[model samples]
Target: MPTILMRYRAAALLGAAVIIAPLSVAAFSAHNVAAAAPTLSASPNTGGSFAPIVSADKPAVVTVTTVIKAENAGDEEASPFRGNSPFDEQFRQFFQDQGIPMPDQSPEPRQGQRAEALGSGFVVSADGYIVTNNHVIDKASGITVTLDDGTQLPAKLVGADPKNDLAVLKIKPSKPLATVGWGDSDALRVGDQVLAIGNPFGIGTTVTSGIVSARGRDLNSGPYDDFIQIDAPINHGNSGGPLVDAQGKVVGIDTAIYSPNGGSVGVGFAIPSDQARKVVATLMKDGSIEHGFIGVQIQPVTADIADAIGLGQPEGALVAGVNGGTPAAKAGLKAGDVINAFGGSPVKSPRDLSRMVADLSPGTSKSLSVWRTGQSRDVPITIGRNTGDQQ
Candidate 1:
């Protein structure tokens, strides 16, 4: 077996042994000698740590169910075609003699609960403000927030930004709501320990532990694509719950998991709390987000292009087009100029520049340093509103 698989199996065996050993102690203690039985540790453990954290955060982790009206009877249609076996593809000519149809229809949506699809959410503020995935509550006509203690309250949509896949909801709880502190997601490194606490598969609050598998993973979810990837088991209903560190401070929101069988294969993605914080704040204050733009369409500088442009190495964004009459054009930033830095921050690629520009304030002036003709020049340009389709 592979080394990683062997290690996983060994760890699983160890966990099972630890939990089952205590039960056999009484059986052995029944002997005539009546020796003291091996006692289980009474102190807190990792698996059981979920209980304490869940108990404390349950009030903030609300069960979110979405209701949407649809016309189609929603069950997904089954595919009528079958894949060729391992050796079947080798004999395609023989099989082609027989008629076979390829699977080619769009899947039908599932039909059943038009009333609700279970998910999770977390309170971000004391004023009964909550943050959840845009999908969890999208197209929901009447949202009801069900507390951990069984209190159901009406909730209103504060604002939603589909680009980030996040939404803010408001509810008037009877008392101050429990809120989790946001941790510095930028400080998280791959292999750092992490925890995921949420309601999974409609089960009560459950917790799972794992480590940061990756960082800044771009799943093509949005323009500001910076996801903190974790190995924690985040299931269907786990979306929108907090991915906290060992300190119980939330570093990311449990957003997505990659599964072919609808079960965790140890791959999961979360929106970094730092980005979510900015989105949530903007949604709360302005009811909509306005991102900054530099009016430059850019591409990644390749080795050949870098050499042609007199760059020592291939790094930074290659400008492809500049919007007419925009700040970048007015600042003499022409096509083919490689932007190396913005506001003293290095621009690694097109996405890096896109994110940095989006995070900037519209109408604010920012400096751009570019490399051209074996020379570097810094140009100041006033940021402009991004009116085009945003990611």
Candidate 2:
């Protein structure tokens, strides 16, 4: 595996680079303060200004190596010569055509195959906290993190959220660690320049630059799939590394790419820093995140459904089904009820409601405003943990 970050195809070509969209940076710079003048001998060394942000973050990036132990053989593995296997009919036809006898299936099982994979991660805290993609460590019995200095450490799983494809890790580093500063991902706009740093294909730490192609993108990672789409070069080993902005702050975590040839396609996906930080915090503090549930399967009311319901315009999430004893059902919520408000946040669509519920604290009661039977009313529902058993 290469450890360097892959280069974006479009941006690297020098001709296909997209326009950089102007972003609102006022809010992001609101906390900037002027430093007091130094009293004596020499001027303090101010951090050098830079355009790409991955300059200082490279040290915090690490290469993750995983070992998979597989069984050598199965007790009773299915034979390729039997049943619906393509080789079954071919074997039978071959014997019939060539006038040769076919061998009987053996009772013994076949041998198994083992595979090893590599990925990347970034340090988020100096105390040995790291973040990476859950899929990178999935089913991995052993994991090792290799720093830039050739130092290797055994990492333990702090917590993992498969729904969002994220995992938290803790390494027992004997020395102080370098960590990346978090950025305001919400402040990033489409076309903003970004830098991606990671170990791609087991290569040493590599840095690639590109622009944010889009924001609030949904790659079906989960209900809260608001990702930042970038035209950065991201490959197999880039998963879980930081997507830094121009200020050397981590704005996102590189996760996936839209590719058919198993290579960079100039379209990479990353989890926003805002959302990732929340997951990291929950994993660090409570070892798990407690998701809020509204207990209703809602769909955005379309024109047809709105007309059928006699509503003048289509809006809000239409309750398609309600859990029998869930909080929504207990609050008199029924199918066809249009949810317009969750707590005080506007509910524009199913995704909106899903985000609202997920961001709320579990067991906390929230107010919902719904339109039903030509009337709007408020209903209270106590949010519940997802528990992985319910929608």
Candidate 3:
């Protein structure tokens, strides 16, 4: 098997990044205002201690608390037997005739139950823009950010990109807020020293130290599944926290951890800062991102399949199925064909192609290199709006 494809079987990405104990979602609200792109800066840590970096960046890191509405709860109290049906009324009447005391039938003001949850986030701009995971504030009825000084402020959703598992939040503060700058995730190498800071289990802010274990990990969460794998002990409430480097710059966002038990097992996944910076910039400006979609089911070309098709290498994404009336179908991309390159970029695996395609904007036209019938050819195609990212 190809080494790239083997990673999927070796260990699942933590969405393939999983949180054994899921962080609570269900908070909600959107703000009409948008902020400009974030300003980036970093103060390197020279001392052996992580104290300097922490001291510089910790102020920007925050605890995200959310009040989410319970979907199962209702607005008013009603008898359990009083369901929405004529038969339910008859059943209640029957119970009344039997001299049985039924549950309360009188309507009372039963407010929708709200669940409180905690996670972590970091300020990206001095103007009060914050970066966190989409899952952190997903479905929240209200959101709050607690600063390091213990000041709490209301937060509003600016925009969210679930495919990337990221969201942007806005808070109007009285003054400029402390901010952590973005670092180059592409520069991160395996074994590089790093720090994971967050409010694990909602017990205030905590910091963990580790190295970048791996890069370009596909958790299989979605099309844009590339993540940085780390050995830091990121836990439940660390969901949207920042993964910093010795340079004191934000390099990744702690998202999920792989554990059979509900704790960190030395396996954690983070959204690369390079990716997050782009998404955050777009969200702050446009309020959302529209991923490009091509309607096709794909799988990595295994060695066996490669040999069968006389392909010298098991690389690129193999077309498994194509949805009709979609971009792939319209481009005459057929089953059994292999997509070796997309928009001039080499496709090393299905994951690579997925990430590449999703990075494209809808209505953008690009050339796709296809291998078919013992030959290769380039095909022109236009990207389509992703009504859904499944394509």
Highest lDDT against the true fold, candidate? 3
Ranking under TM-score, best-scoring first?
Answer: 3, 2, 1
The reply for model 3, stretches above 4 Å from the true place, is 1-43, 72-112
Pairs clashing in candidate 2? Answer: 1-201, 1-202, 2-200, 2-201, 2-202, 2-203, 3-199, 3-200, 3-202, 3-203
Task: Tell me each candidate's TM-score.
Answer: 0.74, 0.75, 0.78
Q: Write the per-residue lDDT of candidate 1 for residues 1-391, one digit (tens) a residue.
A: 1432243233222210000000000011111212222221122235646555545545567766454443211321111111211112322332244443222222333444233444578766655677787656655666666676667778888887766767777788767666666677889999988778776655566678999999987644336777787898876567678887665667888876644444577877788887787777777666777778877778889999987878987989998988788878888998889998999999888888888888776888989999877899998988888776331
**Cα-based lDDT for every prediction:** 0.63, 0.65, 0.70
Model 2, residue 216: displacement in angstroms? 1.9
Q: Give a tens-digit lDDT track for model 2, residues 1-391.
A: 2222232221112111111100011111212212222111112123644423444667778876555444311221112222222123544564457665444432332234333445678766665767787766666667788887778889998887766667777798877676666778999999887888776655567788889999887543347778788998886567777787777777888876644344576877788888777777777666776777768887778999889877777878999999988878778899989988888888777888888887777789989988899888898888877766344
Steric clash pairs (candidate 1): 74-109, 74-110, 74-111, 75-111
**What lDDT score is found at residue 324 in candidate 1?**
83
Q: Which lDDT tens digits does candidate 3 get at residues 45-132?
A: 6667888888877788887766655441232111123242112354356446766544433222234444455568887766677878
Q: How many residue pairs clash in each candidate?
A: 4, 10, 12
